[model samples]
Every structure is written in C-alpha cells, then in structure tokens.
Target: MRRLTIWSIPIDREICAGDNLGDLLGATGELADGDVVCVSQKAVSKAEGRVIQSDPEHLDEAFEAALAAETRRVLRVRGTTRIVETHHGFVCANAGIDRSNAPAHALVLLPEDPDRSARRIRDRLRFAWNLHVGVIVTDTFGRAWREGVTDVAIGVAGVRAILDLRGTADWTGATLRVTEVCIADEIAAAANLVATKAAGTPFSVVRGIDPAWLAESSARAIVRDSARDLFR
Candidate 1:
C-alpha cells in the first residue's frame, strides 16, 4: 500500500523583497530527503520583488495597465474578471496577478520564470542541507468548468511534472491510454489541504512520493500546446 503524509510549515515572519527563501525555509527544519516542498507563489513573488505599486485613487486603471503589461492575449472577459494568457504561457485569471496578500497598494505578479525559480530553490536546499528533494511553486487557479479554485503547480524542479501511463496495464489487464497524470499539480493541491490561504503557512512538505518520479522536470511540461488545445 502506498502511503503519503503532508504538513505545513508556518513562516514565522512575513517574507519581504530580497529575503533569502532558501535560508528561511531551511530554518524550518521540516524537510527530508524525497520530500516534495510546495511553496506558495505569493511567498516567492514577495521575496523576488515581483510586485508593482497600484494607485489606489485610480485602482481600476492601474489594474488594467498591470493586466495589459502581464497579459499576452485576452481570451475572455466577464464583468471585472479576465481570463488571459500570460507571457509565461499560463492561461489564468488576470494573468496570475493577485491584489490580496500583497503589500499595501501593491499587486503581486507571477515569478518571471517559475521553472527557474523552482530550480534555484531546489539547488539552494541541496547545497544547504545536502538533501535531495523536489520543489514546487504553487498558485491558485480556477478550472475551465470547475467552481472555486485549487492550488496547482506553476513551477517544478527535481520532480516529474507528468506521469505518462499511456502504455501501462491496469488491474483488469487492460492497456491504458491518455492517462498522463499531472503529478506536480496534484501534489500542490494536496499540500493546500494544510497550507490554507489565510493560515500564514506558505510552505508544505509532501512525503512518500514514488522515488521514480523524482527527476529533472519543469511545470512548463504541463501546459498543453495550442496546437493540441481544443478549448482555446
């Protein structure tokens, strides 16, 4: 039987620009070999100074400008919400910008290169702790037909983003097709069970992942190319 365990690590202090996230997380002393670390996107953004000031007096115009700056193309607009493609090729609401959980009069933008951000954190941890682990940067995203939101992996390192099971045989001895699993997103969602948005728990550790899944990977692999995307 495969078993898994997950728990949150509370960041004792607010993460600010230029903060060393690797050092801060390492200080938590909760990580172990083979543990997958799920970090909130807000924490990474704050640390990386990926924030922009929004004028409160003209917030709507400021927001629109920010949205335009971050957006690659506008796909849908309903009321004040926008579903658009970002420069990073992520299709999400408002280009993955967040007004909540940000410094006053500021908006947090997604990391410039999430895959690279994940690698930096992974490498830093490897150097600091001498432990091999996977790192995932997570953000909340709404599904096309689903209600509400769930955390998904926007960045991944030292972990397989997708588990392709197309040729695998099931218990009934049937060949499986089109059964690729988004491992990073699923892990991020599971971590959200403990790393609640308002809990100040920006980090979570998922243990007991299949060791075979630990390898060089990035979340970009999870994005479906437009040529194959039917919804867009």
Candidate 2:
C-alpha cells in the first residue's frame, strides 16, 4: 500500500513583499523528487505584494471599494456578503480578498496569476536543488452547499490537477463510469491541516506523491468552463 506523510515547515518571520520564496525554501532542507510543496496563498500574496489598505475606522466603504476593484462580477449577494467572479475566473467571496490576517488596515488580493506563480517557484526550486518537485499554492474557500471552508489549489505546477479514471474497472471488476479526482485541491486541503491559524505555519511538504500523478497542469483546469457552468 502507498502511504503519504505531511509536515509543516515553520516560517520564523512573516513573509513580506519582495521576499524570495526560493531562497527561503532552500534554507529549510534538501528537497527530493516526488515531494509536493504546498504553500498558503496568504504568503504568496505577500511575496507578490498583493496588498491594499482599508481604513480601520471607515471599514465599510473602504472594504466595499476594495472588493469592487478586485471583483469582475457579483454572482450573488446576501446581506453584506458577496460572491464574486474574479478576472482569472475564480468565483469566491469578495474575489478572495483577505482582511483578517495582515497588519492593521491592510487587505490582500489573490496573486495576479497563480499558475504562473507556481511555475516560477517550481522552476526556482528545480534550478537550485536539481530536484523535480510539484508546487501548489492554496487558499481557503467555501463550497456551494458546504457549511465550512476547505483549502483548495489556486495555483499548481508539476502536478496533476485532475485524474480521470472514468473508464477504469473497479475492485469488483465493474467498469467505473465517472470517477475523476481533483488531486490538487485534495492535496491542498490535506496541507491546510498543518498550515493552520495562529501557528505561523505557511508551508507544508506532502511526501510520497505517486510518480504517475506528477504531470503538469494548472489549477484552472479544475475550474468549470463558463459555458458549461450550471450554477452561474
């Protein structure tokens, strides 16, 4: 049986804009093949300088303005909550604007291009360590009917975003009809368990990735196409 292990990498200092993630990870430990590097979108946002200011005193208008700037369209609204579609086609609350984690009066927008960010980090790690590893950047998100949130892959590189086993046979020799897996999101959720709140753990390593699952794909591949989307 195949087994996987996850462990958090404690980041001693808060990640700030212009900080080099490759340099930071290099100091952690030697990386190996098939190692999945899972990163929090919060940290990636800081590195990419995706921050804005909202007045602590007049938060209502300022927060709404920031949300408007980031949102491509408002999908739904209930009371003060808004579900929006971002330019990158992500549909989430407030276009993924985060307000709670940063220092006072600051808000963080999602990375400009999460897939590109993942590729950059993957390339840097490969160049420095000569190890072919996968990289996934994650963020917490609420599902359509789910009560709570779960971590999902907003960025991915050197990893399989989706695994289609639709035609494969089951253990009972029955043909599987529609069995597809979202590997990236699943891995991100698992990593989030370690990279939790009040822990300062922004990074995690998911070991024992199956070699067959190491193909390249972006996180967007998992997003439903606008044409085929039923909810929208």
Candidate 3:
C-alpha cells in the first residue's frame, strides 16, 4: 500500500544566499532510503540569491513592449496586475516575479537551474547522513482549469518522476491508458499538507512509497518538450 506523510519543520529565518541545505536538514534528523524531502522553491531561490528589487506595479513602455513580444500575445493586464505565459511555457503572475515572503523592496525569482539544485541537495544529504533519499523542490502553481493553486515539483532527484504504466494490464486484462502517474507532483502536493503557507513550514518529509520507483534521475525527465507535449 502506498502512503504519504508530511512533517512540519521549523525554519526560523529566511533562507538566504550561501546557506548549506545539507547542514540545515541534518540538524533536524537523519534520512533513510525511499524517503522524499520536499522543499519550497522560495527558500531555494533565496539561498541562491535570486531575489531582485523591482516595482512590478510600474512598467515602462519598453518593458511592456518586451513582455508583449516575449509572450507572443497580449497578456492579461488589469491596471498594475499582469499575468503572462512566457515563451518558456511558464504561466505566472508578473512573469514569475514574486514579492511575498521577501524583504522589503525585493522580489524573488525562480532558481535558474532548479533540477541542479535538487541534485545538489540530494547529494549533500547522502554524503552528510549516509542516507539514500529523494529530494523535490516544490512551487505553488495554478492549474489551467483549477481556481486555486497547488504545490508542484520544480526540481526532483533520486526518484522516478513519471510512473509509466502504458503497457500494463488492468484487472480485466485491458491495457492502461494515460496511466503515467506523476509521482513527483503527487509527493509535492502531499508535502503541502504539512508545509502550509500560514504555518511557515518550508520543508516536509514524505514517507511510504514503493521502493521500486526510486531512482537517481534528473527532474528534466518530467518536463514535456513542446514537440512532445500532446496537450499543447
């Protein structure tokens, strides 16, 4: 049986530049095989010094033009509120420039290489604690049809991102269709149950997953290229 658990951790200060992820996690406890550690992207970005100070409310004519050109269409602009789907295929408010949870006059940008960051964290945890565990960097994302937002995997390591059951037979001997489970995304969502925004829990440990699904691989495997994205 597959089960999930989320643990609330105490992260007192904002994760800033030059923070060691391994040390932070070790201070809490030791990890074990098949364990999944979910980390919020906000902390990862902060540790990487990706914060920027900018007034998203005021965009010059040139900035507006650039945004329009990059998106290939006019994005939603209501007064100062702007939501755009960039050419890189990310749909976010203010082009992913986040102002929440940041110090005054600063906005946090997504990490440049989230997958690499996940790998780094995983490796460090393994080296420091001698544990085999998976790491997932999560971010809150709005779905296409959903009204509210949910946490999704921005980075993952040491776990199978997708559980492919294409040729697997069902109970009635019928082949499964569209049964590629997004295991990483599921873990991220489960972690959010404990790592809530109001609770200030930026980290959570997910336990009780099938051991066979654990593997050392890049999160890039989960990203669907435009040419292969059937929905797009």
* Candidate 1: segments with Cα more than 4 A from true spot: none
| Candidate 3 stretches greater than 4 Å from native | 54-89, 228-232
How well does candidate 1 score on lDDT at residue 186? Answer: 95
Q: Given candidate 2, what's the lDDT at residue 28? A: 84
Q: Candidate 2 on 1-232: residue-level lDDT in tens? A: 8899998898988999998786687678856788999988989999999887666787767778788888888999998779998888899988898888886888888999999988988888889867788999999898898799999999999999999999899999999998889999999999988875887888899999898999889988988888899999
Shift of residue 183 alpha carbon in model 3, Å: 1.2
TM-score of every model versus the real structure: 0.97, 0.95, 0.84
Candidates 2 and 3 compared by lDDT, better number: 2
- List lDDT for all candidates, in order: 0.90, 0.88, 0.75
Q: State model 3's lDDT.
A: 0.75
The Cα error of candidate 1 at residue 125, in Å, is: 0.3
User: Which candidate has the top score in TM-score?
Assistant: 1
Sort all candidates by lDDT, best to worst: 1, 2, 3
